[model samples]
Target: NDYGKLGRAGEAIAHSLVSSSAAGRVAYVEPFAPAPGEAQLGARNDRGLLVFSGCGTPPTGQHEVARGVVQVAELNNPVLLNFGVSEVNWWLHYEFAPVCSRTVLVAYDKLAEWDMMAPRKPVLEQVRAQLLASSDTVVGLSEGSIDDVPDASYVGHGVDRHWHDPAIDSLPEPADLAAIPRPRAVYVGALSMRFDVEAVRDLADSGLDVVLVGMAPHPALVELAERHPRIHLIGERPPEQAAAYLLHSDVGIVPHTDEPFTYSMEPHKAYNYAAAGLPTVTLNTAHAPALGPFLNATRDRKEFVDGVRTALAGGRLSPDQVAQARSLSWNRVAEAILRAA
Candidate 1:
């Protein structure tokens, strides 16, 4: 599950970071029962371990000696370490602190707030405080993300160089997309709550060809796409295929909503867009400013629409900008983490 078979950002990050080096093996240590389609067993390699660490399942009593440990405190899930591994150095990332040794808490998104009627606000705050207090190092995905945590270092999201590289993967324009009108604006990623539905609607209504390439389409998103003839929904393509669309597109759009969750986000689409050498127009978020002159971060709906038009007219990012983007690879990110650990 860590090294994803599908094209998810977190999975891509895990795969790239773990697979780049030969120093350690990655294995999944799950402690939960399989949910029908889910894999029951964990995967291992020569170097490290990548485990699901599922809940409620009993340990298998198999003890493997571990050289070093990097305990990742994933934001959405609990860290269930029932693996009988021995002699491991632990490193933590993000919210939970099962065993807080050499911890690196990553603030990738603002804490979630589900409902006002049945509130979890206080609970969320307490968790954040406990994690922050226990963490040895607090890292932010963007410069703005560090504001909540004092003295936190900004280590932006890492891009998989191989998947986004045009040389390794051919960027052929799919015939279906090629038939679409000129000045194509492609958005790649999940079509979920994070997306600004209004902005996307506007883009579709603006007479420009809007192509959405991703999975898990929110109902609202599906309705919007259904309403517009110009909006093409080609759901859930593989990384290379998705990259091909981005590479062939005139511009890439990051139509994220302005919300508490988005405030701390540094979207991987920005890096992918830069890697493809396509002009990008993103909603003005905390991380957008740091991306330099390559991206146009618009403040409002008017600006978002105008930014897209402007990007279509403007040329691609300069060689220096592209080089800068390439430098933010997962290889570099993994090295930084290992050094810190």
Candidate 2:
């Protein structure tokens, strides 16, 4: 299947990297099956890269994906095999080793250091060691250290700046957004354990209409929405549609619970909010200082409520602030990777 059909961080990177690649310079291979009938292999030119898709359903194992990747890799004779961490599924990427002249790993997050991910650390550590031995370079998010590998590069996650902009103000408002009373305070990422439910409730109690634009599988959050008329759980949206929600909203927020894992993140949502010209207010964290001046880091629930009011008053980001965010585009990130390779 094509990455474009999905809506996740990995899909975002795949789109950016492929869009940045020169015509016919990159190829993507994945394990996929359109039906239950037979093991099928097919290739097509998508965007700029040749995509080899469809292996089989209930995929037998990693070897099946590896075999297809090897065939495509040999044909393309790629200079670098760029690997992004996808948790346990990374084992599949490991199988495609030695296919390219060099290997590079994009450390999307520091799962090994996260307490919740402790159970998988042993296997991840083993993979880390193997990756270190084989990788020519390791690029990681700036919020966390990448000392596991020598001389690893630390950089922030990138956004497709054009996709989120003040110009979206001229576009039609999203149907679901029309009835949500403003001044709207929006949060546009996962509603996971890291999310601060208390903080959101405080904002709603303070009279700000709170909008959450991601999956709300967590039962607590669902109940909170049921109790708070001001709080709206609008469900998950694709990149483009999600950006519109940010652009139309009064302010963007990251109400993450004060935790080590929360401190370890440099959220792509903040970057997206900045690109959309919203004043982003986030819960204070260790990485807050490094996130630049455009983001307002509030220390407590009271501060968070105040931060939203302050953001609503100040309005969207200034021209210079927008430019700063725009400069950090995925095109530049892809260029850096290509140059490093």
Worst window of 10 by summed lDDT in candidate 1: 80-89
lDDT of all the models against the reference? Answer: 0.61, 0.69
TM-scores, each model vs. reference? 0.77, 0.82
Per-residue CA lDDT of model 2 for 62-102, tens digit only, reads 56555665576454655444444444335545555545556
Model 1 residue 74 lDDT score: 29
How many clashing pairs per prediction, in order? 19, 0
Off by over 4 Å in 1: 1-41, 46-49, 52-101, 113-118, 163-166, 339-341
In candidate 2, the residue pairs with backbone N, CA or C atoms under 3 Å apart (3 or more residues apart, or in different chains) clash, namely: none
Candidate achieving the largest lDDT: 2
lDDT of 2 at 212: 94
